[model samples]
Target: MTISALDLAAETKRLLTELGVSADRYIGGTLRVTSPVNGNEIGVLKEHSALEAKDAIEAAHQAFLEWRAVPAPKRGELVRLLGEELRAAKAALGRLVSIEVGKITSEGLGEVQEMIDICDFAVGLSRQLYGLTIATERSEHRMMESWHPLGVVGIISAFNFPVAVWSWNAALALVCGNSTVWKPSEKTPLTALAVQALFEKALKRFVAESGAAPANLSTLLIGGRDVGEALVDHPKVPLVSATGSTAMGRVVGPRLSQRFARSILELGGNNAAVICPTADLDLTLRGVAFSAMGTAGQRCTTLRRLFVHESVYDKLVPRLKTAYGSVSIGNPLETGTLVGPLIDKQAFTNMQSALEQARAAGGKVTGGERVENGAGDAFYVRPALVEMPAQTGPVEHETFAPILYVMKYTDFDQVLELHNAVPQGLSSSIFTNDMREAETFVSARGSDCGIANVNLGPSGAEIGGAFGGEKETGGGRESGSDAWKAYMRRATNTVNYGKTLPLAQGVRFDVE
Candidate 1:
């Protein structure tokens, strides 16, 4: 059933009550949440204070002490239950995510599905947190490495992917025997509360069936910079996983490093796609359209830059313009709407400002005008296209919006340089039928991104691979592969069974 806006609001209130999180729970200040869909006031949240944030950290740390001893397989079972809870609440929580974070209905549900998928993945990963066994130099000595859980894990997520990012970190962290304390984006606190409530429900069920002490394995702190800073600087939080802009990563990366704590930062992506002359234009058009405009182009992996072979540059730009004109822009909850409003006026302003700069820098910009249909100051704009003479100027950096900057390339090396020119290198793709070109793009000297693709756009990463990037994009992986290892510490053990005290390199020491 398609939930009405009124029903969603009521569901949110009920969820807040059930979760024991409302305006009264926070003392910092009131956060009035306005829906970007139609500029309506959805709800208000109480911002958490520093003391409350510290208390949450303490709770997660205390929980970690027992959680680490629960055995990895048992932890996986709990994650399985969390997946079930997410499955049960998928629609409602997905709808809440849409309402709170300006995601369209389908994208919202997909985000929830991502959470469920990660839970399932983490459950499987519980038993597979493998360590390496080493060959010993001595005859009677065996050496191996064991993985132990890190203490408290701190997660700071962005508004664009409020729930999924948290689950990506928390699910693996939990299965790896670490408790989590999350500080979700203040703009999307309701979704965080809803997810936390569901997680707590799953935790309760696990304890009931297993007869284990109910540890507060997961915690949510709803607030702004104060709470986030507290979480990042807390001595107990040995690892902090953050997902946001490069500027934010610059701040978070240094803070975590100063304390010698590990940080998994999934930061910004000025992702690009290079279209060769021999590329499949039809498929390339579809892939680029979604990559450039999906979620109104707010995705970190969104294809913000396009490098087209000069031979097909003339053929592609017009088709891209036609595609842009067909994109449906309206209320995100509506049936056929594809492009939703920006997160707020600031995002809209960013889009406009970026376009203006593009125009001033010898670039031709089409679309990007504000839509003033009956939505009442809600920020909406047509997905923009900027034809640039070179990859310099405004196209050099990332502006989180549906703006695609197209540049023509003459040579393969030039195209690769254009693709790698941007500072952020999260995801990159090249469309070509030539095997040599395809192989070259994926080679060590080609794309410098963490993810590289052939005949595909630079978005929609699967959960199986480690997702992150190089340089300013924050070289931290999350959401699959051996990313679970980040949540644990490794200790090498040596066993000597033959009862002889020996020193390395045949150096012997005798003590009385």
Candidate 2:
């Protein structure tokens, strides 16, 4: 059932009560959650102390000592139970995601579904963490590689995808027998709490059924910059998975590197799509519209730039303008609403500033003005379309708003260069009916983004494929397709029989 605003408040209160959290305990130090839908206060939460952050890391470290001893497939059974818990709480938690993160109802539910899907993927991967065997120079020696679980995994997620990103790392990290400490976005702590509550529920049942499992296998640290820094600087956290803006990744990537630790960073994406002359306009229209506007263009994979062949530029531009005009911008929980309010006033201001900058730079921009008709000061705005004469100024970087920049390209070579010119390489797509064109786009000489597509939008990546990007996007992989390897360390081993002191490369120094 779709959750309404009235029911959401009551449900949140009930959930807090059931989780043993009381507002009276928070007192003066509390975070007041205001609904972006109507600018009303949702709930106030007590932030975690900095010392508590250290305690959580120590707990995860203790858990890892026991967790890594559990067999791989047995760890899978625990994840399977967690998946079942997510399925049961999908509606209520999804509703919380919608209200807190400003996603439309469907997108909110879809994010929860991503959590469930990754759990399923991790369950299957438990038995499939394969290693490679190598040929040895000596006849009596056998050489092979084995995978061992790393210590604690620290996850820092962004507000755009409150729950799914955490699950992507947590599920794989858990199945690899590594405990995790998650620090979700300060803007969306309630969803994090809700998810932690559900995980504990599943963990309790699993322990009862399977004897003793590791305590504090998963933990939550809810606070702002100080708490996040505590996790990042902690010595026990060997692998830190962070998802946020490029500026944030620039800081996190180096800090983790300084300690010679591992980090998986899913940073900002200024993705684009190319529409060829041989493309199906009907299919192209839907792909471009959704990728450009989905999540109010807040996703890391949102389509920010569009390169259209000159032949169809006239036809596609007008259709796109109409589509942008027709999009319904209002409360995300309302039925049939396509575009929701910006996460806050600053997001609205950023959109406005970008539009103004485009106009000042002599680019023809349509739409993108604030929508004052919605809830009182709710920060709603129309998604924009800008026809740029050149890819200069604000069009070159991402503004984290519903602004799609359109440019015309005369040749395929020029289109490819334009598509790859941006610094961030997270996702890219092409719409073409020509087989050769599609093949070339997927080839090594083609798109440089981590994810490449044909006749499809760049947003909404599936869980089965490894999700990450190259270059400034951090060069880290997550989700599936052997991403589990990142959660473990590899060691090569050699065993010898037949009483021969055979050295590698047939060394003769041993004869002395």
Candidate 3:
């Protein structure tokens, strides 16, 4: 297959410039591309531009025809080239992620690495993206099924793990042959820009490496919720993918259904980690800390609810307090800072509400405090642990903060029930040495989530494992060989060649 940029000159910067965008806060004044984590002010974003939104959709629609028309192999080639570029920019991208989202330096760097993996996986797995061929009852008839990319895909990404999640859509969209319009969370636009810039550079190389068509076929539109809503409802946009809250999913899911378009809705999770009496308390606590505090517990898959076996509940609480206490809290840019501020002012507000609500519900706050004084400029908060009979907190209603709720459960069935109580079913974990209990949880409650692990944190998503919540996690599957296939429609070609072929027609009659 031939590979080339849709147009070599059609780089993201070129297009943005032609669209009359200035480097200085390109879209508007309300949306500044400031680093949410480190406080660097070097990026550009469209705060809320109806015009930019319209332009992005129009551009994606134009690119859609050619991108969708491109052969799958050629698309894969471009994605492969982009992956190479991602690898090269790891250091810079890591810094950008840290600056933009306040991700711990290591975790921030890890996001770029993960994105690279996704790119490589998406590109290399093109062969698996296929359809089924079946023989018909009649000698002359045959049947085929294939995957096809929906037109312009609109991806609305959250602030946390900006690089990783953005690639989830762009790489898959390109590999499946669909033009994409990326609307990153306004709070962390820098990471998205850095990732995209690197991707385009790779695409340019891809076009030169293999002569085909323009490879930079995707465009990014940054703005607030209003901008996202515009993209979702756009007539030209046929596919929508959102990584956000259950409430956002509730609103967006119904809206897309009305249009009869495909939507990959990965919503929030009140994820749980069940710690058994026989497991390693230290290890389990350490692992759960990844989700409860990682990225300040802002991810859709953060470990919000922790269920402990009655035998270990008392022992684990203080251990958790000490372990969580060790996290260094400060500016994201500060060297060795363990935690950064929440994504933005709104996220800070959400965390505060969760704390207040948890206290109202008779939950005890063992540790954790709010930093940054409620100012939107730098919304930072310490990791929180609330002791609750149930997983109750501001998070119960959807706080999405850096807080963990500890619940004590004595029964296996009750643990399963507690885990499944949330509307979301994205990620969950179990800390257990008892093989039987682990087996039961895996068998009985496995259907409730996309990824379930034993002795692991809910936040650490595996590239090899399939991720998609049952109810709101989107009907589509991604992150592996199956991802490309989901973006494509399958088709099969049947040939008779005049050779003797068995038909089911006579066989069916005989069976009857």
Top candidate (lDDT): 2
lDDT, candidate 3, equals: 0.72
Candidate 2, residues 1-512: lDDT per residue as tens digits?
Answer: 32223445565676565544564532344777766766666677778887999998999999999999999999998899999999988887787888888899999999999999999999999999888899988888888999999999999999899899999999999999999999999777778888887888889888998868988899988789888888888999999999998999999988899999899999989999999999999999999999999889899999999999999999999999999999888778878989887888888888989998998887898899888753664677889999998787888898999999999999998888888888989999999999988998888988999999999989999999999998888898999898899999999998897686866666766544
Alpha carbon lDDT of residue 497, candidate 3?
A: 54
Give TM per candidate. Answer: 0.96, 0.96, 0.86
TM-score of 3: 0.86
Rank all candidate structures by their TM-score, best first, as comma-separated numbers.
2, 1, 3
Query: Model 3: residues >4 Å from true position, as ranges?
Result: 1-30, 38-48, 371-377, 392-395, 445-447, 472-476, 491-512
Tens digits of lDDT, candidate 1, 1-512:
32223344565566566544554543244787767776766677777799999988998889999889988999998999999988988887887787777778899999999999999999989889898989988878889999999999999999999899999999999999999999998877778887887887888898888759446689888888999999999999999999998999999989989999999988889999999999999999999999999998899999999999999998998999999988988778777888887898888888888888898888898888887767664788899999998888779888999999998889999889878988888999999999999999999999999999999998988888999999999999999888888899999999998878776678878888
The local distance difference test score of each candidate is 0.87, 0.88, 0.72
lDDT of 3 by residue, 1-512 (tens): 10111221123234334323345544435565654543334444546487778877887788877777777788888888887776766776676577667677788788888888887877766656656776566666667776776778888887776868878777888888888888887776755666666666776677678765643377777677778888888888888888877778889988988988778877777777888889898888779877888888877778888888899888988888887777777765557777777777777777777777888988888666766533345667789998886764454554677888888899888778877877667788888898987787678544377778887887878676666777655555667646655455555656665566665546532342
| lDDT leaderboard ranking | 2, 1, 3
The residue ranges of model 2 lying beyond 4 angstroms of the native Cα positions read: 1-8, 15-28
Q: What 10-residue stretch in candidate 2 is worst by lDDT?
A: 1-10
